[model samples]
Target: MGHIIDISHHQDPTKMNYDKLSAQLDLVIVRTQYGSRVIDKHYKTHHREFQKRGIPTAAYAWVRGISLNDMKVEAIDFYQRTKEFNPTFWFLDVEEESMKDMRAGVSAYVRALRNCGAKKVGIYVGHHLYKKFNLNLNEVDAIWIPHYGKNNGQVTSQPSFPCDIHQYTDKGRLEGYSGYLDLNRLMGTKPLEFFTGKEVVKVDKKDEIKKDKPSDWAKEAWEWAKKEGFLDGTRPKEPVTREELAVVLQRLVKKLG
Candidate 1:
């Protein structure tokens, strides 16, 4: 409804200027730098500042790659640290240029966070990538789109609301980086989770495995939940059972109608 400003130290905090940002934003997602990037460093200092200011906040990372390995590292670290702050949601800043042909792995990072017990997670993508990746909107959260495209909403081809936040113009000419950051009011959302169905590829990581494979219908149900915003992420466990499978199928069919 108000705004969801993504705060990051790497971007220059003074550029944010909380006095101005607070006035324009409702939710502040500070980059805790949770991922496995030891080269540079960041902390939850901004999250504390926002909390003191009484702003609803969360944390995220500049996710570089979309592999299960990349997610596993960041997911474990981000969750372990944020047990204290306990923000509203988590995000994988799916930046452009960095994400190329990794569409299939988009769900990897999200799944990792889910496995670590992250309740709410979402993507921060602009128009360029949303279109570039040929996104499956039904399986993900609303886009944190930042664009000046004349017909921005036209391309998505869904009912115009595909985009949640619009970083209308970065480097706000007026506030000097205190630009307009719009967001859709998040409703009925929860933390994100991740579970793996793929084979245990690593010799050392054989512990995490679902003995039986999932049926076609069970996998279909998963896809459905993801698209409908019911599923947060995946975890490693035995395949969905016939009884559990029946319940999900019935629910989905009812929802479809």
Candidate 2:
């Protein structure tokens, strides 16, 4: 299995060797923000550097909201900043006792993320508080529970509860880094694609053609535009920009002239 690790400003990018780290990592989940405020200083660099090396990446935000409204605000802030990166998943790192009703607060956070168009959402709960918090797990697409068996830089025992991903060690040592890194493992029968949302599917050629080709209603006009040298017959299913429309209009005007 490919190694997975999470990082924040704690793992200084300037000191860390990304060339070695990127070769070993299958996924990298970077912390986006610490709450509604205080965006992680190295988040953008971490995301870009890993992604540049062709490793899939995800984003997580430490949940520090005290009220339900605060939870929503934090979620919006997390999405707004990290959405441009198009992370495979957005995770809520709920570790501290922020609110009286954490269940409701966590649910609100998930809902707000969904409202802002976040498709794949997950939660990372401290293993000790797994049962104590009684978080609304149903709201998320995946659950991540941390169980550092001895925190001895090795995976000793698995998390007691069922989860999509497990953070087995915080003091884990890897070949690329000299310091401690949070190392994770994919649990149970779920494949890596389940978390990355990159599941491969077999498609029939006929169905592919039907999806890519122009619809019957637009076929005649589409052909006419192409034949008349006004429009290029490519990317028919893609959106048209103002610049492309202007060019098309110019071509049509010249043709008529």
TM-score to native of every candidate shown: 0.55, 0.77
Q: Write the per-residue lDDT of candidate 1 for residues 1-257, one digit (tens) a residue.
A: 34555656664555556665567556766677634664224446677767777777777676666465765676677777775888777766676444455565557666777788877676777566666776454555445555543433222232233554455443333242544333233322321212111133444444444423344657877666768755433641445668866776776787888
| lDDT by residue for model 2 (89-130), tens | 999999999999999999999999999999999999998999
**Lowest lDDT 10-residue stretch of candidate 2:** 190-199
lDDT of 2 at 64: 96
Report lDDT per candidate: 0.57, 0.91
Per-prediction backbone clash count: 16, 0
Clashes of 2: 0
lDDT score, candidate 2, position 32: 97
| lDDT: worst 10-residue window of model 1 | 190-199
